[model samples]
Target: MKCKILPPKGLYHPVLPYKQLTSDNTHKLLFGLCRTCMNKISFKCKHIDDPTLNKHDKIHEIKRCKECKNIKNEKCIHSDEERVIVGTWSTIEIDKAIEKGYELQKIYELEHFEKTSTDIFKLYVDTFMKYKQEASGCKCDPKYCKNDCKNDKECKTKIQYIIDNTAYDLDIDKVKYNSGLRFIAKICLNNLWGHFGMRDNFTQKNIVLLLEHITKIVFNEKYKDISTMILDENIVLTEYKEKEEYSKPNPSVNVYIALFTTAHARLKLYELLDILQERVLYMDTDSCIYNDDGSEACKK
Candidate 1:
C-alpha cells in the first residue's frame, strides 16, 4: 500500500508554480541539508563563493546554496569552510526537512499531479503471497537440498520437481527456512523491481567496416565515453553511451516503480532508526544493528 498509492507519478523538475510539493504522507527518504545557513544571511554580490576554493570542481561547479543561486547572491555564509555548497536532496527529503524546521529552498523538485497506479506491484505481490502459502510448510530432501534442511514439513515430495533444479541463494533464510520451492517463489517476487530501474543509457556497440563511418562517429558530440578497438585493417568495434538529448528511455523500464519500492523500504528503516536513536551501532540500506539496552523496542 505504501509503495503503490503513495508514490507520485509524472513528477516535474524545478516543480510547477505553487503546486504545493509535500511528502507529508505520500513518501519518505533520507534527508541531509544545511540548517545553520537557513534564513541566517543574505548575499550582496553575484559571486556567492570563490571557484578556486572548490578543489573537486568537476563534481559541482557551483558551490552555493540553491537559495543563494535563486537570488544570485554573491557571498556564502555557511560556517563550515570545506562545505561551501548547501547540498541537494530528493523531493521527499526536502519536504520532510522543511517540516523539521530546516529552511532549505528547492530550485528543482520531483512533483507529481497524481498518485502511482496501485497495479504496479499487484501481480508480483499476489504471486508471492500465493506461493508463500504453498511453500509455507514445504521442506527439502537431504540428498537434493544443498543447504541444511530443517525438515519442518511432511510434504517434501510435493515440490520435489522444484528441488531438483538449482537452489536459489535468497537471504531470507533467517525469516523462514529455505527450500527450492520457496527460493523459486522468492526470485519471482524480488527480481522484477530491479529491471524497472534499468539505466536509460548503456554503452551501445557499433561495428565499423569503413574509415568514413568511424570518423563520423568519432566527431559526433552526441556520443560520449567512446571506446574503439581495431579488429583488423578495415574493421573496428566502437562502443559509446549517448548524451541525454540522443539517449532514449527503455520501453520496458519504469523508474517510478523502482524508486517507490526503495522509498517505502527506507521509510520502514527510518521508523526503526527513530526508535533506536542513539542506540544504533551500524546501519545499511537493508539492515540495522542496534543496542536495545532493554528498551523493549525490538520486542515486537
Candidate 2:
C-alpha cells in the first residue's frame, strides 16, 4: 500500500518550491528540486550518498554505491521504501521464475526437437555437431600436393588472370604473406555488441550463455590433462588502442582481452594488459614471445 507521506519527522521545512515533498509513513525525508536546477547542480550538490540507503543491503547482493548509477537511483531504492516491492524472486514469486528457467530452453526445443518420436535429438546433435574439431582451412599444402589438375589449360589461365589483375589493376595484397590481426578482435566484438547490446535480438540470458560458450572453448579445450602442453606454449592476448594521450571512449575491450588471457594462459600476463572494458575493444592473439622492445623474436 502507498503510505500517505507527510513531512519528514524531526526535520525542518524545505525553503522554496521543490517537487511535491512526500514523506513515507516513517516520514523519511524525500527530496527533489526543479529539473533545470537538478540538471545543473546534480554533478556537484546532489546528495548522492544517501546515508540510510547507503547502509541498507541490496537485493542482487551487488556491492556498489547506489549513486554510482545516475539514472537508476530511484528505481533501485525499492528496498528503502516503507514496503519493499518483491518480485518473482521474493517469497511470493521465486518458485515460478525457477520453474520457468528450467522449463527447457525455448530456442533449443524449437530448433532441435524431432517430431517423429518424442525423443529429443539435442544430446546427439550437440555431441556430434559441436564436438570440437580441428580448425582447418586451405593453407597452401606445401609438402605433398602435386595436383595434375594444376597443369590443365583452364586452371592455368585462371591463375594467370588472378595474377595479372593483381599486378596491373589492384595493388597486390599486403596482408597475404602474414596474418592480419584484427587490431582488436575481442574488443571489436564487445563494442559492436555494446552499441545497443547486439544487433541480433539477444536477451541478457542469451548473452550469459554466449559468454559461457566462448569461455569454455577458449579455456577448457577437449585435450584432457594436456596442461603441460599449454604450459610449454606461449600465449598472448592483445588489445589495440590507437592513441597514447587521449583514447577512445570504449577502453573496456582491452580489459576483456586481458581478463581472457589471465584465464587461459599458464603464465601470469596480468601486468601486460591494461584498460577497462567500458573504454577499449579487443583485437587478436599472437603465439610468440618477443624482447621487451620487440626487436628480438622468441619463436613459439
Candidate 3:
C-alpha cells in the first residue's frame, strides 16, 4: 500500500501564503478564519482582537467575512455594536448658561472696579450701552441684550462722552485702566447667536447630523454637506437672507460679529499690556495674570 500523507494541524485544507494576498485580502481571510475558530472554540484570538480595530475597520471585516463565508460552510460573525451616543443641550438651557456666564463676569468686573475706586468705569459701561441701544434702535431690553451698541457710528459721540468724562490726559493710569476694562467688557458681552439661530425642535436625526458635521470640521474634512444643510438654498438660507436684508438680527452675522469683537478685544488687551511692559503669564476671556509690579496700573 502507498503511504498516506496528511496536512499539518489547522491546515487540513489548502491555505495561501500571507505574502500571496494583498493586505486587505489577507485581513479578510484571517478575519473569517478567526471568526470560525472563535465560534468553535468559544473565544477570540489575541492577534485578531475586536478592540484593536476601529469601528469602520471592524465593520468592513465583518462585511467581507459574511460575503466570503457564504461560499463555504464557514460561520459569519456579526457584532451588535452600536455607535457612540452624544448628549445635546436645549436652546433655552444654552441661553441660560450664556446669561449666567455674563452675569458672573459682570460681578467679577464690578468687584474689581469698585476695589480700584474706579466708579467712572462702571459709569462708562452704562453710558456706552445706553448710547449703543439708542443708535442701533434695538428694542431688546438692555439688561438681556448681548448686542454691542458701540459698533454703531452714532455711538461714537457716546464714546466721546466716556473719553471726555474719564481723563485720558491727566492720568495715563486711567487710560490703561479703561482700555483693560473695555476689553474685559467686550469678552463678557459676546453671545452665540449663530448656534442659537440654528435652534429648532431638534430631533435625534438633526443633532446627529450636526455632531457629524462638527466632527468633520474638527478633522479637517470637507464639510459641504453640513454647510449646505445649514444654508439650504431652498428654505433656511433664503429665508435668513431675506430677513437679514430687512435689517433683522441675522444670527449668523451676530455670531461672526461677536467672534470678531472678542478677537479684537484680546488683541487690544495684549497691545495695551505690551505698551505698559506688563508680562501676562496667563489669560482667559475675562481676566489675566500679569506682572504684579504693574498690576495696580490697569486695575479698572
Candidate 4:
C-alpha cells in the first residue's frame, strides 16, 4: 500500500510581553541566589580531621555515635560534599538577595523567600498546562497507536484520512506553547539515562551461563575449578566481568547520542539566529522566543 506523506506544519509564533523579558540565564541566576541562601542558613561539620575511607574498607566499618554514623553529619567520612549542608532559607532571604543585587552573604531577617520559588514553579506548571491543553485538542488521528491499531490496515487508512484533511497552518501561539511544553515535559521525563545505562541482570546471567558452557567445552576435566577461578569473589574478576559486559553493544549509548545530537542542532540554529540579527529573549530545547520585527529574515 502506498501511503501519502503530509507536509510538515508551520512553526509556532509567540507574542512575548515586554515586561517579562527574562531568559534561561535568569533562572540560573535565581538558582545561584537560592544556593547562596542555602549556604548561609546551613551548618558545617566541626570534625575536619576524619579521614576519608575507601568504598570496600568503609563497608567493614561498624556503626558509632550519631555524629560518626549519620551520613548527614559532615564529620562522617560517608557524608557527601553536596549533602553536608542542611536546611533551606526563607523566601524573604531570596527577595532580599535579589533587591541587594544578589550580594547578601547572610540570610534575611524576614521570611520573604517563601513564595519566590513556588511562584517560579507555578509559572512553569501553568505554561506546561496551557500547551498540553492546546495539543490535546488535535482531532486528527495519530499516525500510529500501539494499544489498539498495531499494523491494522483500517487504522492506517483512518490515520491517513485525518492527515490528508488536517490543516498544516496551526495557530502560531498554540504551536509555540505546545513545543515549549513538550520540551519541559521531556526535561522531567527524560530521566531514563540512568536506567538505560544500567546492566540487565538477565543479560549478565546469560553471559555467565555462556562462559560456563565455553569453559566446560574447552576443559572438561578442570572445568569446575576453572569456573571457580573465573568467578572468584574478588574485585579483579568483578572488574573483568563488568568490562566484558560493557564491551558489548548498548542501546543506551545510541539514545544518549540521539539526545546530544538534538541539543547540538538546537545550538547551531541559535547561532544561525544570531547571524540573522534576531533578539532572542528565551529558549528551551525545542522552541525559542525572539523579537519578530516583520523582516523577511526574521520570518525565515
Report the number of the highest-lDDT candidate.
Answer: 1
TM-score of each: 0.52, 0.14, 0.21, 0.22
Whole-model lDDT values for every prediction: 0.54, 0.28, 0.35, 0.37
Poorest 10 consecutive residues by lDDT, candidate 1: 1-10
Q: What is the C-alpha RMSD of each candidate to the true structure, in Å?
A: 12.5, 28.0, 26.7, 21.5
**Model 3 lDDT per residue over 129-241, tens place:** 43333333222344422345345454444444555654332221122223344545454433332343343322222322455554544354321223224544333221111
Candidate 4, position 121, lDDT: 38
Candidates, ranked, TM-score: 1, 4, 3, 2
Q: Which ten residues in a row have the lowest lDDT in candidate 3?
A: 102-111
- Misplaced by over 4 Å in model 2 are 1-71, 74-76, 79-119, 130-132, 135-300
Writing each residue's lDDT as its tens digit, candidate 2 over 1-300 gives: 111111222112111112322222221122222222222223322433445454344322233434545443433222213321211111111222223231111221111224334225345423322211101111234531224323555534543454464322221221122222222433443344254322321212111234455354445433222111122234323222222233334433443333323333312221122212112233233332323432222111
In candidate 2, clashing pairs total: 18
Off by over 4 Å in 4: 1-135, 139-251, 254-256, 271-276
lDDT of each residue in 9-28, candidate 1, tens digit only: 22211111111123343222
For model 4, give the 10-residue run with minimal summed lDDT.
Answer: 1-10
Please count the clashing residue pairs in each candidate, in the order shown: 3, 18, 0, 6
Name model 1 segments beyond 4 Å from true.
Answer: 1-110, 129-191, 210-212
Better of 3 and 4 by TM-score: 4
